[model samples]
Target chain A: MNLPPLVQTFVLHFGEMGSRWGINRTVGQIYALLYLSKEPLNAEDIVERIGVSRSNVSMGLKELQAWNLVRLQHKPGDRRDYFATPDDIWQIVRTLVEERKKREIDPTMTLLREVLMQEPASAEERHAQERMREMHDLFELLTGWYADVQRLDTERLVQLLTLGAKVQKILEMKDRLFLVPGSKKSRRDDAKDK
Target chain B: MNLPPLVQTFVLHFGEMGSRWGINRTVGQIYALLYLSKEPLNAEDIVERIGVSRSNVSMGLKELQAWNLVRLQHKPGDRRDYFATPDDIWQIVRTLVEERKKREIDPTMTLLREVLMQEPASAEERHAQERMREMHDLFELLTGWYADVQRLDTERLVQLLTLGAKVQKILEMKDRLFLVPGSKKSRRDDAKDK
Candidate 1:
């Protein structure tokens, strides 16, 4: 309740967003506090800052830890555990993406694969399989692309994201030069001195 | 309840996934049915297929329509309303992304900007604002990239996605050939015949 004004506003907004997403509002508030803090905060600090019950703070911190959204720390000679968000913002984004894929996309893909394995006994079943195939293919492409992007280091990710649509030129160039491997046009280009 | 076995399995999976995400299971089942069906299905058809009550089917359709996840139709002779998912799977993906951005992302960005405008009266406030800036900038980069990708037609999107990390070469190429304006090294590369 007595957070810095700016931090209070950010925490309140996240609290609202969390409830809208069916997450406990306290979880988001707890995360917002940790994210803005320069130092780790213990459960008592979180409960006092956010005006929540001790039990709620405990539950929220536990949920955040489950999501890999926070790191728990213990100071020397201190009995209480403290929490902090990952220092790098990009690391947070990466974790969110990874968790979403694991929770939502992977399960759907698995279900689609299971149904795709079933033999179509009727015309309707055949049509349903076709639809599932389309869904599965789209997930495959997106997940595959994400997996590739995820492997890149954070610096490389920033470069890739900043490139955005400009990469279209590269795709076009690749098709022209590499698609027709060993074409005369491709040969002339790398030779440059001609 | 009497849907083809494959269709039933697909619908059941979506229902489970929907409930997991706090969406109504019936809504997911209805969508699954329509997504697989070759022809538009009336509300009664959904009720019969999913074994839900008429009112639940009506409400589910309304929910789907609200999310822009389904198309409403009317048979020329029948008075009952009918529904179907958008035909192209990519179009469905685009709609889901747009709706999520509208519901979840846009509001958070607005709130972040609002807090960013507040005058920082203390070091704590300043540090909080700096963290906000990092989150805001990351959102900017992601939204910008997505906006660029969204504008591309499906063909270009597929091409872009299929390129995947291989585009790292292009990023390097861009930095080498196009990043600096009018450098001698770049000039030599572009003026191939010289």
Candidate 2:
């Protein structure tokens, strides 16, 4: 169960980065190993590769499953449980975004809304409420946009992303062509559209 | 230096949420206090209100400054430093995104790129490299989009956000009117744009 040097480096780095991403080192390492694994990996495989306690591996796998970042499978002839990451990376990204929004963003939004419901008893409370309202609006808008984009097919999303800064142009064009009526544009501008 | 119940609730919730967001509780509490404060708060005020040690408050303030979530200010004839969050919530959002990208995303991208450069010594390494490439490409596209959006003026950004799912309509309209040639649409459709 020895990992190759490259795998080891990648896993170790991910393990370090995991804390900053809000997961523990072992969870990150386990996810990295499963993600890079050519075949489904069993708990024994993870235990040997990561050198963590059996219970620790069990807990890490559970956390990953909860995050929807890992899936449990069984080998045709094997009795033990196996784990693997989804083959599609885009799905993985979507799952990460969804889970994080659920865990981190949603609660804050809820709290802000609750706080906003309270009557301001003082000037300080009023100012704080104003700030909270601003935050609530921003989060709501951003999350709403994310939800819209999340509905897009992966290919269309990729196309949109590949357009990158060109999207600003599309936004501009939408403003110019549709917002203004009968404004004459050069043929070059027409060609630049979309 | 007792915090009102409302502020206490917000601060405590943020402290609880902080670890999940990859910051320590003290730092989260400190930032929450500063963010809601009507005037700049010195370290002593923070320590008293949050009920943490002076050293902990000092460390948390330092961490918040590093994250660009807090700024230092000075009162006339006062040598002690005071801290406050930016008045504009949008600016705070921009700063948060920028700092998180620097601390978390950028290094991971750099590591993934480095790993991609190495020659895969085996099939296993090759599979790992492939996964790494997918991840690297995803991060690159996302960061690139963020960079483009970051250049937008706050008003433009807010307008774009407020558009939310309507943006998809603009995208579709662009395809219809611009991508397809000589397609006639009603003026009502034109008004619906942007």
Top candidate by TM-score: 2
The digit string of per-residue lDDT tens for model 1 on B1-194 reads 87888888889988988865647899989988999999999988888889989999989888888889999888889898878898999999999998888888899999998888889999999999999999999999999988988887787798778878877776666557554675756543442221
In order, what is each prediction's RMSD in angstroms? 5.1, 5.6
Model 2, residue pairs in steric clash? none
Could you give candidate 2's per-residue lDDT for residues B1-194 as a string of tens digits? 37877787789989999999979999989998888889999999998999999999999998898888888999999999999999998889999999999988999998998889999999999989998998898899999878988987786687677776677687677667654355455433443334
Chain B TM-score, candidates in order:
0.88, 0.90
Model 1, native contacts kept: 0.62
The local distance difference test score of each candidate is 0.84, 0.86
lDDT of 1 at A113: 90
**What are the runs in model 1 whose C-alpha is more than 4 Å off?**
A181-194, B179-194
Tens-digit lDDT track for model 2 on A14-96?
A: 89999999899999999999999989999999999999999999999999999999989998898999999999999999999
**Per-residue CA lDDT of candidate 1, range A38-95, in tens?**
9999999998999999999989988888889999999999999999999999899889
